[model samples]
Target: MAKIVDYGAFADRLKAAPNRWDVLREFHEEWGYAVRPGSDRWDRWTEDEHETYVRALSGEPRDEDGLEGVDLALPIPAALDEWWELPFNSFTHDSQHYETNPVYPPTVRPDPSGYGVAGPLQDDSDLVAPDADRRVCVFMAENQYCNEWGYLAAEAHDPDPRVLVSVDDDRWALQARSVSEFFLQLTVQRLPRTLGWSAEIYDGEEIIDGDEDDLRARITERMPELGFEPWAELQQDTIVYGGPDVLAFVADGELGGIAFAGRTPRAVLDLAERLGVKLTEEDLTEPGEY
Candidate 1:
């Protein structure tokens, strides 16, 4: 089930407005849509708009979350709000080993107190709201979490909403089919360990070092079977193989990480293991705070 918003109607109203900015301002002030700063595109907005939207959707932060002078216009589920309070390094299960990536952490504005949850929305020229207006990215994982990519999106315009996870910009995987389902998984089931900082499970040590050519050959041979093709240069140390479904990260003649659109975590892990990468207990455990 998709949660649809009347984006067409909203667009229509914006088109009818004598002053486009005024319409956007009204949308922000009244209908809770964040007006993008420095851009006339109604779909685009500042990071503050994202924070505002999250705050408005989730209400005030919890007392223990260290948020003050904040009011809840609409009450969001306590569990979702708790997610916002979690420290940037809180993704790892072990509190003692909660490490933050130096590059990504400084960029993230802590929710409830700083910039709410996510960074600015990425460019979406296709639709005002992607996924048929059913979802909006609320948070992005730190770079250390699967190479500083991926997003935590929430269902919009629905009473019973769910959280979605997308490693790449294109496709999404269901994180929680409903809000209650999300809470249950976070608190009890703990199946989707990749949520928040739990993705550290996949951050294993560099096990095998092959020649760069060998690594490229292996990827050229194996990735297509996995539904990906060589895409572009990632960094001086890395090569990227991209497809509609997954992104393969290769570095130093080793497969560093794989971001999947439709693949299961277990399947990806199995593939990694087959490639000679193994997850040690330490890798699966929380890391020390950086």
Candidate 2:
């Protein structure tokens, strides 16, 4: 599929994609995805030596029958249950970790030493007030160990409910209006960090140069579906372009930065060609995975 920035079409895809787990499973090829702890695909990490110390998933296999051992004070929502059944978690590390669904939680109460599938409020990370009354929220994912994102425990029945943020640990704020938006934001934001695919960066350092605005405009001209809004707020000024075969982003750092990720280093060469991005031998790889 051609990479496009058509905002209308993009919005339509986002609206329909939350319930489609099959879209991810279709990327069966490794695509150089960086392996994190507990991943069955750890070929690049530890030189193929899997991390054996990580404990097994606490509950029975995640399925539509309902998270088998994810027993919580509140009922589980159908949308969450559907997401939990993902064949494989594309994430490998803290940048977008959600590998283990609903970890049994900390051994002790109100102190978060253990994590994954749990929230920061339980550990007193100060996301909210220390003395605040605890609401029955079940966190499903975290970033770098503290920032957490989950649906309200009270609204477990909603297919797509409001998403909450604790920042692995926050005072509890609205992350997204619904699970669908949150998932797209998470996947898009983490694409560059976790997906170890072929890429080319136009880093202006005495070489060729292009301002972020021009690059952004050129990209927008090519894929108008994208918006000026940064996909991940944390990565300020970053605009994402996503498709089945490619993922790219333009951001402001110094002058500007743009990245294109493909199946191999040479894979992005095609993108540079199509986008009319100037490149030299230094920007091209030997036609295979880096």
Candidate 3:
């Protein structure tokens, strides 16, 4: 179950710690969260690492109207400062690839090069932008860990407002609201369920070679009637389909496990029903509701 984190108590501890690193270590140890080796010590930034980050920020190509260098105020939430080094997937329930070992926040660079998802601010990027003016912060965590390619964002500049938003292949959807709330939902409400859909089957399930062919035929036959066209290529274990209202996923040949794009979760659920798969309420929920 997701423990209700006392943000007040956490902040107080961070302020009282003689060595912030030591406090972070203790937090991770107690929580069963994994931290990247070097990242655990944020005070030890190499000259090159600092320079690279500075260069990335200074060299950020921007339009005349675009904001320069992340415009948010510094000294972000204390919990985020202490916990950023920990792997997001470590907190996930049934993460396949990122369960035991996961990527660290330092692996991401905060350069505003592409449209958040493609280049400088991808899911793996270390930097998280908190532009309240724009009402979004992209690259908050890995898409795989959250079952949707998304970031911690807010729809409006209201008090205590945030949401999990997924944006893939130009399609986007609000997955959940607030980081703490999302964690509670995932760990408490949806315990034992896999984080997101993927191409590989889990729990000793066997894949039938011809199942992929059948699934593809079904999609090709029904997608048009549902008001979408197959757009991208059918990569190794994933299929990218849909145009304006896009739906993409990494599916096993038999559709045993899958991950769909953010904006089309309901549509994907409908499609799954048509494909003879019945998803539960836990399988997909509306934004802001578990």
Candidate 4:
């Protein structure tokens, strides 16, 4: 039967294996894109450039593939601290051949120093006395079928008392039967469905405990503004939960899609203004550092 796993206990097991890396390399060999070597953007082109690259990838008609015309670049180290503010726990897509898109920050090479392990709480006194009142951030984002794996990770990692979520408007279902179709898939496709989200907290699969419903109720009660409704009756809905922080949201015809950034509305607006980002639903794409 399906059940929640303790993230801490199973953390080490989650590290990528050498064979997994090889598989990713092969994937890149078959479907990789060209990248401009030495470029920090990882030589990845903008969303608009995907079609042009895919057409060439299919050998339908186009330009280069080698270092001169490389399609995608290999994964580079990302910094962990950079993602501290991101609500949902984040992971770099580890498709050996090419690095995953939507690259996360604090890009750094994995070190024995503990890339995924939890550290001490900032306040030692708090550790001596757990506070009943504290909050965490939950980040939410939209994804297609393939990214369900990444979405799963986002739900499992961050562990704070307070949970907040950022959303990527729904854009999962799309047609990509043909090799050329994958290009079109890159474009956001709003589907007429919504997802019921949830999460759990634990040290590992063995010691796992905590109900997503209870967590949701607690967060909503603390915030008192979002007025999130309970979904005990909505059993048929597909529920996603777990990660660094708990995340729960719905994406449907009525909800459209939402991408989460792990920040408060006030922080989001402040950063946007400082960065000259306008406050619109579309601005949800970059929900700020967290």
Candidate 5:
């Protein structure tokens, strides 16, 4: 049987959360973890094993796999500090060869930390903010498929600063008003499509065979209370919706996929029930998480 999370209980917990970190922790505990292939990582490494591996990868002495101590060239946001500490988050600088990250940029690594992390956006950053030169960038996370996401140095001390996304390292804009909102937006939008067990309503699996435009239109008609917001300004028609307990999204125009997720198996399945979409618990054969 698919595990179902109690919507009422989860909603209550979210409202009662003391702060944003608590909300993130709530998802961490519920979302669980997925160990990508070849990522046994910290537990498998002896004290010096990871150190030696980093040194070998960089061709110089280094101590950390990710951005533990590397100078981001600006003050680190408190929310980012907390994000790095989350034990359950799968996003991190584990094996540079295995995972996606900020170091993907070609020009930024002249000062190679060797862990495949990018240095501060120096020199060419005049393209983004010519007047605010001191307000550079400190990229926290990125992936090969998605544009890079980070924060401005000007808002570094603000605990939860606004998020910035770039088409390239230099073409930047506000992705979210605050870090907490950004994480919520990212989680709600991403879970439905990427989670291994999720059903693709329009494209990919073609499980629903619904027209992309119609699927989006009907969803909007049914859940008028839940409004869609831009997932990224550059990714047209890719929008996201979040509720106290449920989250849903529509992807880029070509795929036009619709996905829904909640705290547990039952929670997401209820989306089918509410939307009158046809799906069964048993249909969730693949495991959850990335």
Candidate 6:
């Protein structure tokens, strides 16, 4: 979500400006948005009222007025190909720290205990080695951890920095604080603009002469029209034809096929007899069974 700025800070920035209009201008300069106060009988204004008008000020390119007409007040973040990195964090006195001290040292000194033989040697020394088994959850965790503990390690490590690549994620996180922000932004930007951009071309349409349903009806409604007996087999989105002394016609939208039935052993001979029509090749291949 876009970080919420303090309204008091916003108001303070505009305090020097003369009137509400100046405040609106300064507000836009601070955060790319406008706010308008609500109205009851349609005569009211508030600090946030400017948003109502300025929000409609579009940034879309216009040829007649050129850049002057472009609405720079629109809150849409400029599209960035790369992700913006939020600061890891700030330093504080009460910040959590993980540390360790030796309870007892070796009886015989290997390196620094410096004793021949003893019951147990107590040494006050801190272990500053970083843990190697911490699994990173988010992309930012890697950089944040590196910023904190890059120096201490058993094996030398070079943490490769990463960034969020998706534009959709960046866009929504700017508009609102929800998963539905993308949908809302798209709706607000697209739905109202569809007045000039709509799919009116396909409003009224006609089907081709060999419409799947029509073709099938021609075979079954009058089998003698094609010199055969009537039959129909309906599958999911598919219509098949079969009967005595008939060429089975399978029709599915643009895809149609005719195969030989009862009297014909080969489909080629049947098609040869009933020539002058489109035929689709039969697909005998089965899926995944192979």
* Candidate 6 structure quality by residue, lDDT tens digits, 68-89: 3122322222111011110111
TM-scores, each model vs. reference: 0.29, 0.53, 0.31, 0.19, 0.60, 0.15
- Could you tell me how far off, in angstroms, the CA of residue 76 lies in candidate 6 after the best superposition? 66
lDDT of 1 at 172: 37
Tens-digit lDDT string for candidate 5 (181-276): 566556545443344245555554574644556666766665532322366533444654444345556666434567765545565576766766
Residues 106-155, model 2: lDDT tens digits: 12112342334333345343434566444535544333434445665445
- Those runs of model 1 whose alpha carbons end farther than 4 Å from true positions after fitting are 1-119, 122-210, 223-290
Model 4: weakest 10-residue lDDT segment is 187-196
Task: Tell me how far the alpha carbon of residue 218 in candidate 3 is from the true structure, in angstroms, after superposition.
Answer: 25
Best by lDDT: 5
- Candidate 4, residue 80: the lDDT equals 22
Q: Which sections of candidate 2 miss by over 4 Å?
A: 1-12, 15-18, 27-72, 91-146, 166-185, 191-196, 200-208, 225-230, 233-238, 251-257, 264-267, 274-276, 280-290
Per-residue lDDT tens digits of candidate 3, residues 51-155?
A: 554555576543443233243332123333333344533343223322222222222113253424322233442233443323234424444322232233322
User: What's the true lDDT of residue 143 in model 5?
Assistant: 53
Query: How would the candidate models be sorted by TM-score, starting from the highest?
Result: 5, 2, 3, 1, 4, 6
Instruction: State each model's C-alpha RMSD to the native.
Output: 17.7, 9.3, 15.2, 21.2, 7.2, 31.1
Q: Could you tell me the TM-score of candidate 5?
A: 0.60
The parts of candidate 3 lying over 4 Å away from their true place are 1-69, 72-75, 85-111, 118-132, 141-161, 167-171, 184-290
Ranking by lDDT: 5, 2, 3, 1, 4, 6
Which residue pairs collide in model 5, if any?
4-266
User: Which candidate leads the pack in TM-score?
Assistant: 5
lDDT comparing candidate 3 with the true structure: 0.35
Candidate 6 stretches with Cα past 4 Å from truth are 1-214, 224-239, 244-290
